[model samples]
Target: MYWPNCGKGYLGPGGLDNYGKYFNCTGGVAGYIDRAVFGNHMYKHPPCQKLYENKVYYDPEGILGTLTSILMVYLGVQAGRILNTYVNVRDKVIRWTTWGVVTGLLGGALCTFSRDNGPIPLNKQLWSLSFVLVTSGMAFVVQAFLFMIVDILRKWGGRPFFYPGMNPIILYVGHEIMRDTFPFAWKPTTETHATYLFMNLWGTFLWVAFSIFLYKRNLFLTI
Candidate 1:
């Protein structure tokens, strides 16, 4: 149950908040915080209508969102179980790959892109069934490929990725805290796609660097 558009085009795809004015569907950092915390979502429709209209219809931070996240965690646990149970690398890889393909195809089949309100679009905000299956499938496939390369072949050291993976919560919070700060992000001289892409990549690289630094110091944040 999701509204097509949260007040005056306030919500957009990919978990973006449209800042009450649709200017590229990009939510500012402040806007994201405000909407996430205060729920000051703007809608395309006018005021004074159905009671549901006034309520937070497209709530990704709600209980439903938590349930979807739990489902994702369950998938991760299943993947971990495969690794722990299978002594043979071939068996683990085959199982993971098979599940990946099965879920990916099933999710794709369920998706209908003909209409905006079609059956089960890959909406992260809604955390729809198709979105979960598709992402889980991709995660499984990637995990399998990496397991083969790193654990079996011993090709990669898993430097940056492993560092962040070990301290995901800390790195996530740190990144969010420094997202709009200097060196991590900036108002680019040019507003081109390439410029934005480079800035975003640079920000990510900084977080990876921070994670690696923490790893070198033998420091990890765990709850």
Candidate 2:
């Protein structure tokens, strides 16, 4: 809450021009209250909470983020345990679907119909409980779908995904390192959605290519 650089460079309650001057900040009561209610950053970035004040900020690496991440990890471990426990693919799918739907509903119940505001908004930067449950639920659902498709039906081999899945750490690190570099991202001549979409798709293709190269060479990075 007392981080000096928490919401730096972002506009605060004072209005558009007033950057980082919302509350008293620097160990003030109002600042503490604001931080407690919100997270960090400010109104500019999402996922916003438009109900209470619509000025809730987000801090991806804050205390809230750490706590929520621990929960996410625990959820992932439980999912893994479920996968290991069930030998039958049908049983696995049923369990995963049940978990996914239940958790998803629980997460959705925390928020309202509106995406931006609710009793508890799904803010990823803040690592809201809603976000954790919803995303984890989606992950379980996807896992079930993929397991059924690949393992049970044996329709499509995972292809490019299989390659990247073998070396996710390297792919993640490489993408981060080269995200702003040439070929991955660039200053567009025309700032249109098409250009932005193309750039992002191109970057993803490059990563898939790189993953394939590593796979072919029998190279993998693992913890």
Candidate 1, residues 14-46, lDDT tens digits: the string is 221223233322222223443566564543332
**Local distance difference test values of all predictions, in order:** 0.65, 0.68
Instruction: List where candidate 2 sits over 4 angstroms from the true fold.
Output: 1-58, 187-201, 217-223
lDDT of 2 at 60: 39
> What is the Cα-based TM-score of model 1?
0.64
Query: Candidate 1: misplaced stretches above 4 Å?
Result: 1-58, 112-118, 166-170, 187-198, 214-223
The clash numbers for all candidates, in the given order, read 6, 0
- TM for every model, in the order presented, reads 0.64, 0.68
Best-performing candidate as measured by lDDT: 2
Q: Which candidate has the highest TM-score of all?
A: 2
